[model samples]
Target: MTKSLIDILDLSTGEIDELIETANRIIENPQAYAHKCEGKKLATLFFEPSTRTRLSFEAAMYELGGHVLGFSEAASSSASKGESVSDTVRVVSGYADIIAMRHPKEGAPMVASMKSLVPVINAGDGGHNHPTQTLTDLLTIRRKMGRLDHLTVGLCGDLKFGRTVHSLIGALSRYEGIRFVLISPQELTIPDYIREEVLEDGHQDYVETTDLEAVMPELDILYMTRVQRERFFNEADYIRLKDSYILTREKLDSAKKDMCILHPLPRVNEISVDVDEDSRAGYFDQALYGKYIRMALILKLLGVE
Candidate 1:
């Protein structure tokens, strides 16, 4: 059977841990795995604009000595000519051993997976899921905090449409003693489905509030996200909420010295620039981990590991 990573739920707890371990090994010994995917090809079909995810996937394949070919935007692909995702994947699967797709539609990758002969990895989908980013978050937490369990993770900013936050919450809930402090505006609260299905179903402990400062002192990890302007329906609404949550160095005065601060990157003003110099700021290191973890995922899917 072929495997595809369309959602974080597609991977079991054990599999995620195994991938993390593989990623760590790759980081420690880069030379040993340089040619692991030699002679393989990866196709990146990004129907949406991306900097970190797209480049990280390309870099991951290159590090494993695999070749990459694909488009960065929908305009550059046959989709611009009204080609369907299924048709796109069906065509690309013949050219590549594996496919990484990022689309604006929620289930675009899932639809592609149904038609793809090769492994299909979802780089991201329209505010729906970003499983790879979840893996990156888990690896970052494990490496920085020394464990995935027994942590109070504070998710600040736009939780409603932040796919990274949604995926991270689902992934972390599988562990023991994982608590969530959801900090966002009332309009930007986590969707009811996630609250009901993930947190409530798992019997996880979580608190919801619009206050980031109040929750700052209790968090073991602070996961920040930008209020995505693209996800907003109204320009006025986006303008109003964009500056609602900004993490400053002053806010860290109440936080634990070891509390790791993470952001999914391409951050607007949600995170103040002064926080970048702090030792606890792990977003940059988190980006580096995205490359390594993605390498593990590519290897796993391509049967190279």
Candidate 2:
């Protein structure tokens, strides 16, 4: 049977640690892993527009000595011609060794994985899940903090529809002493399913607040997220909450000097540019780590490790 990554929960904590270990190896020595995927092809079927995820997937394949071929947006694909996701993925499976897909609809990749003949990676499915991003987040956290357990993780911004936030919480909940500080406007608080199913049921320590500054001092990792305009049904509501938590240097004073500041990029004023120079800012390095972790994932899914 072929392996697919549609949700972060699909991967065990041990598997995550292995992937991080592999990623660190790739980081320390890139040439040794080059050509691991030689002659294999990765087809990226993105139904939505993206810069980081898509490019990183492509870069991952390329760095591993593989080829890439796919459309970047729906308009560029047969989806623009009324093609179903299952049909698109089924067809692409014949042409490529693997597929990494992103769609605007939640569970579309799950639908694709069912029909795909090859392994399927869900890049992002609406605001439901982004397993690879969650992987990247995990690797970033493990590298920066030197451990995944016994720390407070501050997730701020649009948590209600933030798939990265949802996936990260689910993954981290498996670790010991994982406390979550959820900061977002009341309208953009985390989904109840996450709060109930993941946090409450797992007995994870957490607190919900709209205030970012008040909880800064306690966080070991501050994962900032953008208030996605695309996830909002109402523009006015998006406009109101978009500026909810901008991390400035002054705010960093309250945070631990060793605290790691992470953000899933393409910022929309949720993070101040001045914070980029701070030693705590790991978001940029976080983006770079995405490539290496993705390289490990591609190798894993391909059975080429």
Candidate 3:
């Protein structure tokens, strides 16, 4: 059976630490690992639209001396001709050394992985999981704070439908002394599986609040998420909740001196552009880390020495 990253839990805590260490080393000496994936090929089969994740995977492969091939949208692939994910991945897997797939439905990537001839990565599958993004978030947290544990992390905005938020919480729950301030409206609170199964089951400390400012002071890391319009079934409900949390320069006044603000990018109006000038803004840096961490992940998945 071929290995795949269908969920963040697929990797142990030690593996995450190893990936973070590899990413840091790559940051320090990128030239040395340039040829790690030479002669390898990566297939990016994005059935949904994406700018950052897709490009980062492509860029990671390129930087690792590997080639990238695949469609950026479903219509561009054989899926437009009514081909199943299993067939598409099985065929593509024969052509590429690894596969990264994103689909609108949950567990689609898992199905793809079972049929894939090589390693398969879930670029994203609905609002289910995006393990690589979780890996990126972990790397960003480790880089900025120098520690992943013993800190209060604030996760603000659409926790109910944000896959990145779900994945982040799952990954962070493994660490010691990690308190979560889940900031969202009552209507947009986190899923029961995460709250009951992951947090409550693990006996992790957490608090849910509708106010972002009230918890801003206590946070060492603030992970903000946009209220995604696509996830909503009703337009009226989305319009009402979309502006629930907006992080601005003034909001940072109450925050800790060294608090790091992170966002899984392509942010809508959730984060004001002016906050980009703030010293604590780590979202852009977070995106850059995504590429390096993905580079490390590609190396690991491909069994590259």
Best-performing candidate as measured by lDDT:
1
State the lDDT at 286 in candidate 3: 96
Which stretch of 10 consecutive residues in model 1 shows the poorest summed lDDT? 237-246
Q: Which runs of model 1 end up more than 4 angstroms from their true locations?
A: 228-244
Least well predicted 10-residue stretch by lDDT in candidate 2: 237-246
Please provide, for model 3 over 149-232, each residue's C-alpha lDDT reduced to its tens digit, 9 standing for 90 to 100. 999999999899888998888899889999999999777899998899999999999999998988899999999988767877
TM-score of 1: 0.95
Per-residue lDDT of candidate 2, residues 1-305 (tens digit): 47899999889899999899999999999999997999999999989999999999999999999999999999999999999998898899999999999999999999988999999999999878899999999999999999999999999998887878888999999999999999998878988988899999999999999889899999999999887678778899877766558888988899999999999888878789999999999999999999999999999998887
Candidate 1: C-alpha RMSD to true structure equals 1.9
Candidate 1, residues 1-305, lDDT tens digits: the string is 47999999899999999999999999999999999989999999999899999999999999999999999999999999999999999999999999999999999999989899999999999878899999999999999999999999999988998889999998889899999999987878999999999999889999999888888889999999887678777899888777668888998999999999999898778889999999999999999999999999998998775
Candidate 3: clashing pairs of residues? none
Q: What does the lDDT read for residue 50 in candidate 2?
A: 96
Report the C-alpha displacement of residue 264, candidate 3, in angstroms: 0.2
- C-alpha local distance difference test of each model: 0.93, 0.92, 0.92
